[model samples]
Target: MQLAQQRRAFIMETVRRDGAVRVAELVERLAVSDMTVRRDLDALAARGLVEKVYGGAVAAPGTRVEEPGFDAKTALAGPAKAAIAETAAALVEPGSVVAVSAGTTACAVAARLLDVPRLTVLTNSLPVAELVRSASRDRGEAAVPTLLLTGGAPTPSAALVGPLAELVISSLHVDLLILGAHGVSEEAGLTTPNLAEAQTNRTLIGAARRVAVVADHTKWGTVALSGFAPLDRIDCFVTDAGMPASGREVLADTVGELLVAGAE
Candidate 1:
């Protein structure tokens, strides 16, 4: 493996296993200079995989300790989310029914769906459904895919919850389920912070013929409060170019297909 790639893998694996690791230890273990280790940590930190501290780094909190408000997450991973959303949006063909989960990444995908013709979008995100409707109206196009918003209580993240959403998800099967996760791991699989959200994800996964998870590089390694799908359940993973080498390895070894978008 390339030295830079190896350094990233070493640091990620260390954090995944240890839950937290220091820069000095990473430098010693990877047999790289302190400067190199710090650079690796900086890269990982940029993706939100690890939290950088004085002389060390810690695993990002797995649980939904603080779900960023809708506006915050929308502006947080701007370029990466756009790349991922663009790639995912292309996968939807005309007249296809797609189930979109609730997350900032999924919200971005909804925004790009503005131009897709004749799309029936099923979603548990209030923000996404609203966006789809607004786009359809603004374009003066045929009411594209009929928008189906899963009925449920709204979470702080703008996710629709309660048994009503589950009922809506369980009743129908779709061509694709575009999902987002708090963490993706070979061991823990797809995970999320809220148990209700995880249950909702299960319903979405079960109802779709194909599952495509849209997550950025930051979601790697951190395990959330609940497990949603095993790695094998995901047919395709759409992530940005900045994903770590170790994360790519885990995804390749675990998921069926890995599409690294925004990479040269």
Candidate 2:
């Protein structure tokens, strides 16, 4: 079972690397039977990692299986992320406890939160904790003195995700959760390719009184490997103006509130 999981991970990586992968190629590369490669591709496709094509598979359209570096994600959808972050931050109340999930957009939300007075933040994101800590130093310890960091195994995106992180997250509750995702879709709702991250995110969702998902327009229709929440589970969906009217309509109907940030 463990070996199968590892092989599936390798196949997912291959599809991500070249945008598509052939069953014959995998058979040759892994010294596995054609049946074995087909089964692996089937499993990956079922998990929304790849799309099975003729004699091959392609990365799921507009979605990804491999986690990108934090800096790389930060470079994407810059204007949209800024706008989404500002809009999402507006949901925070002064002097309230908030939980932030890990991602570049979540870090942006964390940065926007500095002006709020005496806010205590609980987060599994290393970048978010670092950002808040630096801000506190600049303004004095009293500015935002209470930033809780969960210690766990780190993900590729600089997030502490695993059993240790989930254990800490499960014991605490916050007023709101500003969550980020590797991808979002009508089918998957909220998802990440990293299974551990998905588990950690599920814990974060349970710990929060209200959940707000922050995603750029590009995330629409993208589905990752593991889904933590369906659309109805989200309390609010905050996105940028780049979202089309059709997407906006669907979100407004499905989520509690759909807030779109204007041009940055």
Candidate 3:
């Protein structure tokens, strides 16, 4: 293989095994100059294959090993998230109730849902709830469906946690649930890094008649700590065109429909 390709492969492999890696280690492992390692790290960061951090590089947050901070995730796939959110928003008919999970992608979907009319949104994400409220106020529409915030302990990423969140989720029935995942695999299904969050997601899924998973391309084929739901439970999946063919095929085999937004 070419030097660049070999370097990238080595970096990814190291991060996968060690959960995180530093630039110095990469330079030593590849026998490449520090400048060469930095360039490789930059390229990987641009592709969302790895994250560039202070003094080193780390595995991308959504991968099984590293739980990415909210800011990092929000920046990873801005355009793809916008497209997925827009497509998902279009699926909601007027006056329908939708349940959204707590994730950056789901937050984007909430932002898009702001344009829709007379809808009720139920969510376990503080940020999503705030977005919905802001949108409702901006439109000056009082008739919009109530925005319910599941009250609970806050996770590092502002995810509502604890039993209260699950109780709130179980209390409502919704027409659609737009969810996000830490990782998705053909065998392990949809997974989340936190058990409390997974339990909350399960409650939301159980209460919805239809489930739509909103995720960017990079989330595919990874594994996390807790499995939220099996692939068969999902009614639809909305993702960007950049999703890998193998992952698409796996999703197609598992879910009822796979909608590729922004695809040529």
Instruction: Give the better candidate number (2 or 3) by lDDT.
Output: 2
lDDT per residue for candidate 2 within 1-264, as digits (tens), equals: 237767887787777778888888888888888998898888878767788999999987676677788998999999999999998999999988999989999899999898888788999999999988887778877876389998899988999988899999999989999999888777678888898899899999999999999999988877776788998999999999999888888898899888999944
Ranking by lDDT: 2, 3, 1
The C-alpha TM-scores of every prediction are 0.74, 0.87, 0.75
Candidate 1 vs candidate 2, TM-score winner:
2
Identify the candidate with maximal lDDT: 2
Backbone steric clashes in candidate 1, count:
2
Q: Which consecutive 10 residues in model 3 have the weakest lDDT in total?
A: 60-69
| Residues 57-164, model 1: lDDT tens digits | 887765232356677777777899999999998888877889999999988888887667778889999899888777668765475557889899888778988799
Residue 206 displacement in candidate 1 (angstroms): 0.6
The runs of at least 3 residues in candidate 1 whose Cα sits more than 4 Å from the true structure, single-residue gaps closed, are 1-64, 141-143
Each prediction's RMSD over C-alphas, in Å, is 11.3, 2.8, 10.5
lDDT of 3: 0.82
Q: Where does the lowest 10-residue lDDT sum fall in candidate 1?
A: 60-69
Candidate 2: Cα lDDT at 129: 90
Error at 39, model 1, angstroms:
39
Better of 2 and 3 by TM-score: 2
Question: How big is the positional error of residue 24 in model 2, measured in Å on the Cα after superposition?
Answer: 6.9
